[model samples]
Target: MPDGQSTRTAMFRVKNLWIIHLLGWVLFMSLPLTIVSREPSAGFPVRILQSGWFSSFFLVYATLFYGNLLVLVPKLYLKQHYVAYAAVFVGLLVAIYFSKPFERLIFRNFRQEQGRELRPEPPREGFREGRPPRPPHGGDARPMPRPNGERAVDFVSLTLFIVVWAVAMAIRISREWRQSERRAILSEAEKAHAELSFFKAQINPHFLFNTLNNIYALAVSSSAHTAPSILKLSQMMRYITEEATENYVPLEDELACLENYVELQKLRLNAKTSLDYEVKGQPEGIRIAPLILMTFVENAFKYGVSNHRESVIRIAVEVAGGDIRFLCQNRIIERNREEERTGVGILNTQKRLDLLYSGFYDFDIHNDGEIFTVKLKLPGR
Candidate 1:
């Protein structure tokens, strides 16, 4: 993806996150309006809103929610400061409890602003006028029961505070986990790219070294094919320097490069050597990793060609549906020390296949005394 497009996508997600949070808070703070009273004359819902208690409660909890999410969890809880985190958490809880009186004060002031004086509720029906009712046994007067609504409100406040804290912790922890996962994925990708580049670096020089040696042999012997070999070498070099720098190239371009390589190798072949190469299926829009198949083809010519014995090299490529299959078979011949020393290309190519294709591709090689064969299947785009 382009950097600008990725940046825009990230920004869009952040904006959506903020919007969702805003909507959630709005619904949460509006809960007081949903409270209905059996006694309509009590005006429970309107009184709750007008008293300013719910507003103050919402404000404090909102601050705590964000503070815990953005600061406490990240700076203390996630860092393993358990003792300090517990202490700070208890302190916030105590602060919330103490803030109840402040909330009542705001409610009182709000009522005063509306030109209404706050008043205590009248005693229950069992109580005499301005006098407490006696207990049935008359040992000691039983304490009057508190109103259910008042008890429910206190319980709900504490419950909501704990709920908000848990939610904040859950969100922060989840966000941290996602971030770490993203970092790990990016790190793996970068390492694979660097390793692949190192492999390509190895393959390029090894390929050039062998190709230049072939051209030099022809030039020294004054073979008429020397000039054409040099021209093919130039074309191959251009493809390497320009197109092959990308991770993938058109399948046709890769095949054309292979054809040029085969022609160049032909300049050194004798009557005892025979080469058969074939390509099937339309490769017009197919794309493959650049130079991925070159090392195997080069190995065929390197180890399978001999002036003194009959040698045969067979190569075939087929593209069907979304799959690409390649086969290379060559007759093994005795190799000199120099030829044996140049086995790095095949190893490097195998590593590249593992890095780029991994489980998505299949590769196999077989060597039986006189014959060597390689088969590879890869997914194409």
Candidate 2:
């Protein structure tokens, strides 16, 4: 994908996440409005909104949710500060519990201001017998009992706090996992790209060295085909420097490059060295990894040619139904010390194949001390 498109996609995903969070919080906060108990009357929603207890509880839960999501989970829990994180969590829980009394006081005062009692007062004892209520003497006044539903309300509120904390932690952990996976995928892609470039660097110079040696031999012998060989070399180098830099090139272009290489090699061969190169494919719309087929062809020419002894090299390519089949066969021959040290191109090409194609392609090599054979099958682009 293009950089601009990728950036736009990332931004779109971020916006979607924000929208999801906003909707989630809205739905969560609206649950209380649905479950609130109140007499049917005008402005019921407004009265509930004006209640100090409702507003206080809403604000407290919202603060706890965001604080845990943004600060506590990432900064403490994810950083492995387990003891500190637990301490902070317990502190917040205690603080919330202690604030309940303040919430009740504010609600009670709000009800008094609205000309209503927080709850109906119990009947006075001995009042039905026409006896005057005894005045509290000194510090002997009895304390009122706690409300019946207060404990249940506190239990429910504390449960909500725990639920919110768990939700925030789960969300943060899941997001972190997704981000780590993305980073790993990107790192792997970059490593493969770097390795492929290194392999190409190795293959390019090695190819030039061998091709130059062939051209040099022809020129030293004052052969008539030397100039034509140089022209083929120029075309091949143009393809390498220009089109081959891309990961994949048009199949026709690769075939043209291979033909140039074969013709260049032919300029240095004798009658005793037999060569056959054939292509049975219409390589128009297909594409292939650049220079992938060259290493095997170069190997054939290097080890299959001789001026004093009979040798054979066969190369073929067949393309059919979104698949390509390539074959190279050459007779094995003894090599000098310098030639024995020169299989870097083949090794690098093998590595490149593994990096680029992996399971998508099949490659086979066989050598029986007389004939060396290579067969490769690749899916088309």
For this target, which candidate reaches the highest TM-score against the unseen true structure?
2
Q: Per-residue lDDT for 141-180 in model 1, tens only?
A: 7666633213213444566678789989999999999999
Note the Cα lDDT for every prediction shown.
Answer: 0.82, 0.83
Candidate 2's C-alpha runs over 4 A off are: 1-11, 30-46, 97-147, 307-309
Off by over 4 Å in 1: 1-11, 30-47, 94-154, 336-338
Structural similarity to truth (TM-score) of each candidate = 0.81, 0.83
* TM accuracy, model 2: 0.83
Q: Model 2 residue 32 lDDT?
A: 56
Estimate candidate 2's alpha-carbon lDDT, on a 0 to 1 scale. 0.83
Worst 10 residues of 2 by lDDT: 101-110
Candidate 1 global CA lDDT score: 0.82
In candidate 2, clashing pairs total 0
